[model samples]
Target: MISATTILTFIGMATATYCSRILGYLLLANRVLSPRARAVMDVAPGCVLISVIAPHFVSSRPEEIAALAITLLAASRLSMFPTVVIAMTSLGVLKSVFN
Candidate 1:
């Protein structure tokens, strides 16, 4: 069974998430971003992705680190689908061999 504090925390988090999303929609509705703002927004997704993935990478084994490096290099030279495939394949092979 869950404690009362844990339940309340979950409810609080859900409410905060909903409120922030709704507020953002209301504020941005029918509005155009400046070119500078748009450029920042364009970079935001990749930056956010890196921020989220960085922690996992930091805790990864050497093989995982090598896989990430290979993936990044592939990403620079290839498209998204191919990069993802290469990354997955490399990670699988490395994990199998190293583990």
Candidate 2:
């Protein structure tokens, strides 16, 4: 059973994430961005993704570390959809094999 505290925490996180995404659009809605600023915007999502997944790099598990390596390799050589597919498939296989 989920505790009330856990549910509230999830709600708070969702609200915060939603508000931040919306706030960015609102702030930039009328402004014309420079080429440099546009490049930053293009890479922002990838940076956020790396920040979220970076903790996995410090994990002691062999399968997780291996999976992260595989993810990095795929990300370098493939498009986003293929990279995601390869990462998820590799992680699932590695977890099953290791466990």
Candidate 3:
């Protein structure tokens, strides 16, 4: 069901993404990141994570908010796999009970 335009757009986007990454790697392959640059890179994931999650948290229901809090707490105490499982399970249970 994909139109030619849609297919071309997808290909264009994919090419752009790969080109950007390749360009970064090629340009920075031999360069050492400054301390500031390294620090920025280290915090980038957390900044992006907050940017992504903050909006959803703002709009979500109380049950979802509770689930998010529980997930955060679980994340602090547990590793990735257990945290993910707990978050998904809690969300599923909350959704089932509330909605």
Candidate 4:
């Protein structure tokens, strides 16, 4: 059960986080970015994802690693709705078996 205080705290955090993103976009959207800047922006997400996720994956516990493996296996074997269902099933089984 969520208390009123917890609800307000969640709302406040969400609003602040959203405003920070909106503010950044508002500042950048008005100016035309250079070709180099645009290219960097395009590549940034993959770089950021690699940097962020690679550390977590490399540093993962055995169970988390197992779950990741299952997710990847599911990814390879399924498509569309089946892919989503298979991934979620993998997640459930992995969590139960490993954790």
Off by over 4 Å in 4: 1-24, 45-48, 67-93
Tens-digit lDDT track for model 1 on 13-92? 44554454566567777789889975764454345335433654785597778888887889799854475557666766
Q: Lowest lDDT 10-mer window, candidate 2?
A: 9-18
User: Candidate 3 clashing pairs?
Assistant: none
lDDT of 4 at 49: 26
Predicted model with the maximum lDDT = 2
Error of model 3, residue 39, in angstroms:
1.2
Q: What lDDT tens digits, residue by residue, belong to model 3 across residues 1-99?
A: 335674565355445544655665677789899999767654543443344346547855987788788878996897544755576567667766887
The global Cα lDDT (0 to 1) of model 2 is 0.70
Model 4's alpha-carbon lDDT is 0.53
The clash numbers for all candidates, in the given order, read 0, 0, 0, 0
Quick one: ranking by TM-score, best first?
Answer: 2, 1, 3, 4
Candidate achieving higher TM-score, 2 or 3:
2
TM-score-wise, the better of 2 and 4 is: 2
Cand. 1 Cα-lDDT: 0.62
Candidate 3 wrong stretches, greater than 4 Å: 1-29, 75-86
The worst-scoring run of ten residues by lDDT in candidate 1 lies at 44-53
lDDT of 4 by residue, 1-99 (tens): 335674565355445544645665777888899999767654543343233234437745765576567656664676433533454455456656765
Between 2 and 4, whose lDDT is larger?
Answer: 2
Local lDDT at 66 for model 3? 82
Task: Decide which is better by TM-score, 1 or 4.
Answer: 1
